[model samples]
Target: MPAPRIKSPALLVAESGADREGHGLRRTLGRFQLVCFGIGAIVGTGIFVGLSDSVAQAGPAVVVSFVLAAVTCVFTAFAFAELGGAIPVSGSSYSFAYAGLGETTAFLVGWCLLLEYGVSVSAVAVGWSQYVDELLHSLTGLNLPHALAAGPGDGGVVNLPAVIVIALASVLLVRGVRESARATAAMAVLKIAVLVAFCAIGFVAFQDGNLSPFSPAGLGGIGAGTTAAFFSYIGFDAITTAGEEARDPRRDIPFAILVCIGVVTLLYCAVALAAIGALGGDGVGDRPAALSHVVNEVTGSAVGGGVIAFGAVVAIASVVLAVMYGQTRILMSMSRDGLVPRVFEKVSPRTATPVAGTLIVGVVFAVPAAFASLDSVVNLCTIGTLATMVTVNIAVIALRRREPDLARTFRVPLYPATPLLGIGFCLYLIYETGPATWFQFAVFLAAGLLLYAGYGRRNSRLGRGGDQGLTPGDAGRVRQEA
Candidate 1:
């Protein structure tokens, strides 16, 4: 068998342009919408659901952990800015890898991205269930039965609400990107409003003593919490997945990525300070509905708690929409490269979206959301995302060296130094994730390699002597659409 060739950077750009103009996905997103899409994705379960665990692990110093994680995310966000400006393609780091590294490496990156997006949606759904249950109990003094609300490990039959939320998000995505983006924007507004309320009400009862001995768990604990907190920032890259759908992708995608990072970081820090200041680390960190719980404790208002719960539900739903949208697009990109089934690349003429692909992805994760305990998936999402970030940082440097003439709408401010630090921080966070995550990451890669060897390697379009050739299945689907 002939070895698959590395796709040249110029060829990758050309193919992306072709995909835009030739019976491909519509470009309906503007800069503001892109920014909204990003914020909607970035500010979800990690803040509402995951923050308590982070505070527990790091004590009052969890605020420091939030900063540490943001700093780590900022470094990678810079790398993503440069690459998104230059590439502006749907596959994100996977496509960047193909342009700089080769098919094998890109395949592995894409596979990890699959895990990152899938597990992330499942995890977010699980968090959504928590908030929904909270809201129900607060409003009516009734909660979901344990068997219906909890995952198996939690001694439940299935998380039925989690599956329902995933299904609803999938339906919105199938309607079209414009509708999805609008929904996301509305939900993003609600989410931000709720956080602002939380911060405002929480400060009224702030106690300096609560923040005493801030680093009770010390540097090691902060490091551990930073790893967990990193999960909050994972959805920023989901912005890059919408590159082909953006009106001025080269300019808008990069700008949106960095802006999303700044906005989300500030919100995270503010909320962390509010929760810990109002009730202390132990008081806020050890509970499931910590943020809402803090608001109730501080203001003594059950209605405020219900409002927060409602906001959290919206936040998680927005995340589900964004992440699911990202997953389908990435799969579509890989399919266009002949690394996966071509059906994923087929867009519905009626919706201008990948309907068939979207349904498949939604169903795949919804099952897990229904029956699985994905609390552990949070660390897995962090590790997989950090791994992708490492690759993206390397891709930026490699592209600069190999394609210096490529016009980038945005460039990394400090060049090699920034990308290097991005890589370093990602590695540090990966280490903090510990040996178990490393083993899981390795096993995932091993499985990807096996799948690639069995299929992707043999069927790659570049190997077949074509650029963006539709598979037989895709060809028939296009004819029908035409």
Candidate 2:
């Protein structure tokens, strides 16, 4: 016989030599550090730049859209909470799906996450560049040449600052998670501070007239804005990726995910309301209708706009740090599972961090950051990530059926109903974003599927009795069929 494939219903990829051989490391993460990671990742992307985009799409009713986004995330967060408690692994739901669904399904989940994380880094970096460029002009009255500051479509050869930020973030990831979380926390604070300032300054000039055309595009605008604003919920899932490192993942993961989503939604609503109040509801939607310029009209000086701009810069810095951090961990998890090159699985002995894995991820983000558009990249990020959330909702159902006996630290509050709602909401968001974004998402997912067919299927350690090294109870871990 050529071979009798040892099919594992669970999607867990058995460890290969690359996994066990490379890590003789230690654990350094605690609840506080992990919380910082959640906060860092959650705070950046929307506040810095997407704020204008959401405001434009939803009009002043973007606040209502934010509530919708938060509500949707809460439903999924419940599903994630259940999984984090049951399967405290890195890869988030990708790992959970492997153990609950099957290898093929797990591969898809992992692929979706990679799509989310990879494109997210690019989106964050591009946003960071915008802020950095503005901060530079404000601080020194001399900014980078427009050619260097922008992407090709914007008349630039390369986005120098975006690449630089991505490069720096990669270096930080290679160091260790704790060190990274500290930096992220600091940046998160500055970003939030800037936003609070926006609220204060923008509110002073608030006019009742701005709320007149609350839904300029009608209720459809609110729906589209809610869909567009789903981008803000992307980073909350970063909470679960740290399951292994968290001091009490069951409690911490659920808490962080929910808290981050809630907090971020509040921040986004504040910024949206303030911008609409000062800019007449439809103002500050696009680059030409920029948030800073609108603030200038009300505050009468660049100081207010400068503060928000500065905040955007600081916020994006943390985003690059946090998203890059999430990206490295996802690769490390896959590496340990034999889905990718072994070097990516290697963790540093001194720092107990995935140094090699982070370096490779760094290179991936830097290239795109050097060339891509902030708007396109961010939307592309949403399609893939929202797809992953869809999978998590599915995985929640699969696991309930497959492993009812498994310990769950936190259960989805409404069982099947909650997860189903999550799935529906995610799909709706993807639909409103348009067909083009989905096209890119499809292309990226197709690439991942090809990689899995060509490499993952053959190299999977479970196909080789490689996971027998796991603890006795964990021996049948990946094969617990539904």
Candidate 3:
């Protein structure tokens, strides 16, 4: 068998331009909409629900853990920014690997991205169900029965809310990207306002004594907290997945990413401090819906809690929408490369969207979310994400060496040191995720390898000499017509 080929940087740029102009995806997004996509994906379950567990693990020191995780993400975001600007493809890091590494490595990165985006959407949907239940109870004093409200593992027949939310988000995506972006942007604004409200109310009840004896669990606890907190930062990279959809991808994608990291990090840290300050680590950690509960306790009313719960419902739905968008786009890119079925690459002429791909991803993810236990799958998602970040950082270094003259709208400030630290931080966090997660990741990768060997290797267009006789422009036009 022939070795897997690496796509040249110039070829990638040319092909992307062709895809943008042909019957491919539309480029209607601007900087504001792009930044909203990042925020919409980032500020959901992690801050709204997962904060309690992080606080439990690190006590008052969870604030520090949030910062550490953000620092790690910032380093990686730089790598993403540089590449997203230069390559400007829907595949994000997967495309970066293809351009700088080889076809095989690109397939693996795309496979891991499937896990990162697909499974994470399911996990977020499951979290959304909980908030829906909370909001319903607060509003009408009625709670969904266990059989209807949760998955089998949680003593329920099916998580109806999870399925419903995923379905709604999928419908919106099928309608079109512009519509989805508008919905996500609105939700982003509402969710940010909700968090700000929570912070305001939480500060009113703040006690200095609650923050005493910070770092109660010591460095070990902080490390564990960092691992937990890192999950919140997972969705920030979803920004780069919109490379082909952005109006001016080279400038705007990089700008949106940096803005997203700064805004999300500030919100996370503020919420952490507020929750700990209002109720102390132990108080906040003991509650199920910690943010809502904090607001209710501080305001001495269920109305406050109800509002927070409603905000959570909106916030997490946007996450499902945005992350699902990312997943479908990745699949579309992989299909275009002949790494997956061609149906994924088909763009609806009417909607200018991948309707079939969107529905496929939504249905595939919704089933696991409705019937299976995904509590542990969250760790699997996090580890898969960390693996991709490591690849992205490496791709940066590799691309710089391979294409020194490629135009970059944004560059990693410290170059080698920044990406190296990103790799190191990701590896350390992966270690902190424990041997079980490592084992799960290995199994997933093994399965991906077998699938690639049996299918992707035989079907890859580049392997079949599809681009052999053509220039980059011709290759892209042929792909569009195919």
Off by over 4 Å in 3: 1-3, 18-20, 469-482
Please, what are the lDDT tens digits per residue for candidate 3 over residues 39-123? 9989898888789879988999999999999999999999999988887788888888898778888999999998789998988
Candidate number of the best lDDT: 3
- lDDT of all predictions: 0.86, 0.73, 0.88
lDDT of 1 by residue, 1-482 (tens): 85536776556656666234554777889988898899998888999989988998898888889898998888889888877877777888888899887899899989989877888999999999999999998899899999999789668999999999999999999999999999999998889999999999888888999998898888999998898788888889999898788888878888899899998899999999988999998898768878889988877877899999999999989999999999998999899899999999999988989999999999999887888775768887888889998998898888888877766778898878988998999999999998998998999889999999999988898877888543554333212211
Q: Number of clashing residue pairs in every model? A: 0, 2, 0
Q: What is the TM-score of each candidate against the true structure?
A: 0.95, 0.91, 0.96
**Candidate 3 or 1, higher lDDT:** 3
Residue pairs clashing in model 1 are none
* Runs in model 1 lying further than 4 Å from the true structure: 1-4, 18-22, 468-482
Model 3 vs. true fold: TM: 0.96
Q: Report the Cα lDDT for residue 177, model 2.
A: 69
lDDT of 2 by residue, 83-176 (tens): 7756656778677677666666777777777667877888777777887776666677777888887788567888889888888888887777
Q: What local lDDT does model 2 show for residue 436? A: 88
Q: How well does model 2 score by local distance difference test?
A: 0.73
In model 1, which range of ten residues has the least summed lDDT?
Answer: 473-482
TM-score of 2: 0.91
